[model samples]
Target: MLASDVCPGEETIAAYVARKLARDERDAFDSHLDTCSACQELVAAVARLAPSQSADPVTSIGAASTITQAAAEALRLPGAQLGRYSVLASLGAGGMGVVYAAYDPELDRKIAVKVLRHARAGDQLRDEARAIAKLAHPNVVAVHDVGRADGDVFIAMEHVDGVTVRDWLRTPHRVPEILHVFEQAGAGLAAAHRAGLVHRDVKPSNIMIGNDGRVRVLDFGLALADLEPGTIVGTPAYMAPEQQRGEAVDPRADQYAFCVALWEAVAGRRPEAGGRRPEPGGRRPDPGEPGTLEGVPDRVRRGLRRGLSARPADRFATMDELLSELFPPVPRSRRWM
Candidate 1:
């Protein structure tokens, strides 16, 4: 009745979708799938994900600079193969997994593929990828497909050409430009919220601003549809007080993270070290106390402070309310109405 109980060497989701199993084996696996919703849903989605559209061209490729060729090769790079895509170059490495720019010859496009570090994490990745693929917002990174190749789980995604918000913050940016990009990032979170999902991780590193001047929120690796209490997950520096306490989290948690990161972008420092690491649950920094706040407009400063409030109820009730405050309506001319 459980996927774990299923004997090893059964047809993988990809193999099942590809009809690579022998008749008897396929029938047995089909019988097993009836009780294994995880594999059943995975195989269904993978089948539905078959190349149905033309590829969107990636104007640019390599954006991240880390993990050298030799290092990547050790991770099975350069000529490494995963499902329908082949590795082209290492994009970056992170806690979730190493990302590689890959070529999907079937789709005839360059896609960024995340290869999970643990062979056992295939189910988790499948759940995460399914949730992300359902989110189709412009400011959200697009998940094209997911598959199991050999002993690895890989997610093929739209390759973004740009720097993370953290790296982008290293440069000088006018307040308007900063808020504009962040608004896009917030929109991505807002969209996820509307879809009943919460981005448990919302630090600057998860946000990307492309060369095309578009801001995208990437990596739903830590996202959850119904985040319950006592689920501590996210960067400590940007976590909401409730999130740090492992209490229930909603979209407001992401709003808190957004403000914290935005304040850092403005002040060039984190508000407060909530904790030394994940689940530290330390005090949050006062947004108004940062010396740099003097240079920031009162309107923006006030909004950030409310968003960084210790209590979720005290913050903007929703992302729409937050955006309304961040970018207030221009006094419409009486004539325009």
Candidate 2:
């Protein structure tokens, strides 16, 4: 018997319905489930009911992430190979599935693949795969392939070798270096927002730093429509106030986060637990967060302050504006060649 049989009331109903939908299409109502605890609990229950197929202990950073990691660990099957790609090792897990480092023998390529566990084995995974595949940008990580193998749904993407923005901030860097990183990151976010996608979760962990000193955004799993309020998403520290209350959002939301990240990078301290303070003439100066713009060029500091505006409308309308300010077009000499 399934766990749905033992659950009471709406939980059972939600579980059965979700499971059915998950069987049909895993991504169909992922945004729906992310916000609904009853549904999330049901999904968690279904995962718990599934027998353990592997002996590995699921290691994760926090409580909310455990559900996804544990679920991925349970769904791992034996001797399953797909389309010239061999699964090598588990990278990490998120709210919905497990990502693994896979090897492609035919082209001699390495890829990071995420597979849905439990009810996410079907359409839900497909939808996320499709949504992410549509976005092709240098700063935005690309989705290479999506399909199913041995009853599990999978997404194969470019494997980036780098540390997260969170990892980079573990130690202090020169203020100038921090500013350059923030400028690049803001450019990426602006590009994605322009394409009509909202990255619901934009914390330090989701930002990857390449060995070449480039910053890229990862995990569009929680992305949604700019105006929708379906799922209450994002980590608390980096999450905007509206996200916590399940309200509408847009590019400005991303801009706000970019500012916060910049703040943390430069100041090396989390912003105080208060909303953005308003300023006259539609401008607000840095709240004197020590070293916020210390050692950075004044031009970049002005842009960062604008992007972090409490009101979305008051911030840069597009990432292009922010990038141009951060990295002005420098003329190159033809004689160099």
Q: What's the lDDT for residue 54 in model 1?
A: 21
- Model 1 spans > 4 angstroms off: 1-74, 117-128, 224-232, 273-282, 289-292, 331-337
Residues 1-337, candidate 1, lDDT per residue (tens digit)? 2243483232244454444555445545654553453444334333333223123111111111111222323354577788878889776553335678999899789989876543234465556667778889999999898777775567788999988887787789887788788889988888888877787779887899899988999877555222344745455557788886788788999998899888777776666533322223334656566455657778888898788877788999998788788877789668755
lDDT of 1: 0.67
Task: Candidate 2: count the clashes.
Answer: 7
lDDT of 1 at 295: 74
Question: Could you tell me how far off, in angstroms, the CA of residue 38 lies in candidate 2 after the best superposition?
Answer: 25
Give per-model TM-scores: 0.68, 0.64
lDDT on C-alpha atoms for all candidate structures? 0.67, 0.60
Score candidate 2 by TM-score against the native.
0.64
Provide the lowest-lDDT 10-residue window in model 1: 57-66
Q: What TM-score should be assigned to candidate 1?
A: 0.68
